[model samples]
Target: MVGALIIALGILSAGWLLLKALSRGQTADFTAIRLALARYLALALEFQLGADILSTAISPTWEQLGKLGAIAIIRTALNYFLSREMRDERGQTSAEKPVVERAD
Candidate 1:
């Protein structure tokens, strides 16, 4: 239940950000918005994994354990890629910024 709620919140927050960006009249900082959404999704995935763990703990069937393992692997992969992408984007953004040289 809590996991679902958190996921729902993430979805709503991302949707709001998208709408806000769209309202900016073609001048929206889309990269920032995408980063924010990715962060939310990654967080939501964590909560979901926790929920799955809890659920499996209550019923230790082999089938349930297998499913949980698969889910965990998939979610972990997703989080890893998301983090990598975010890091790359941040690096790119920083590299694109103009660095001012100090005047002696």
Candidate 2:
């Protein structure tokens, strides 16, 4: 159900990244590509985390609860790093943008 959807989204994201890379060739902006992929990964992880929570809510089994907790922690860690990297990339991108001087 939700798990299958999550897997499908992940696969789609990977395929998109591959296609983007191939289309761009050597002129690819790796930072932008990384940011885009990271965004997709983060979104997919959030959906996965939500699904885990829902599963535990419906079952309340100790095994399910344990699995949910572990999965939540892992997803949180991945999202934290992905967000940090995105922030760094955005900062670098902004800094690299050309500044134009206004002539009065």
Candidate 3:
């Protein structure tokens, strides 16, 4: 239940950030928004994974273990992709910065 709550919080946080960003009239700043949302989601997934581990420790049934394994794998994959995208976005943002031209 706590894990579920954590996931919900993550989603809510992401939504809040999106709305806040949009409200600021800076639609072009999606990179920052995405990065922030992804970070929250990743942290929430970690908490969920930890919760799953704790649940399994208390009741090590085969079915429970299977479910935990599947969930962990899916969450991990999501986190990996999100992290990769965040890295790419950061690189692109940095590259898009305007270089100052000094007058001689």
Report the Cα lDDT for residue 71, model 2.
Answer: 88
- RMSD in angstroms, candidate 1? 2.4
Judged by whole-model lDDT over C-alpha atoms, candidate 3 comes out at: 0.83
lDDT of each: 0.84, 0.79, 0.83
Q: TM-score for model 1? A: 0.80
Compared with the true structure, what per-residue lDDT tens digits does model 3 show for residues 63-88?
Answer: 99999999989989988998899899
| Highest lDDT scorer | 1
Clash pairs of candidate 1? none
Off by over 4 Å in 1: 15-29, 101-104
Better-scoring candidate (TM-score), 2 or 3: 3
Of models 2 and 3, which has the larger lDDT?
3
What is the clash tally of candidate 2? Answer: 0
Q: What are the per-residue Cα lDDT tens digits for candidate 2 across 60-97?
A: 98888888888899989999998999999999999999
Best by TM-score: 1
Per-prediction TM-score, please?
A: 0.80, 0.76, 0.77
TM-score ranking of the models: 1, 3, 2
Indicate whether candidate 1 or candidate 2 has the larger TM-score.
Answer: 1
Q: What is the C-alpha lDDT profile of model 1 across 11-95, one tens digit per residue?
A: 7887887787678775535677778778877887898899899989997899999999999999999999999999999898889
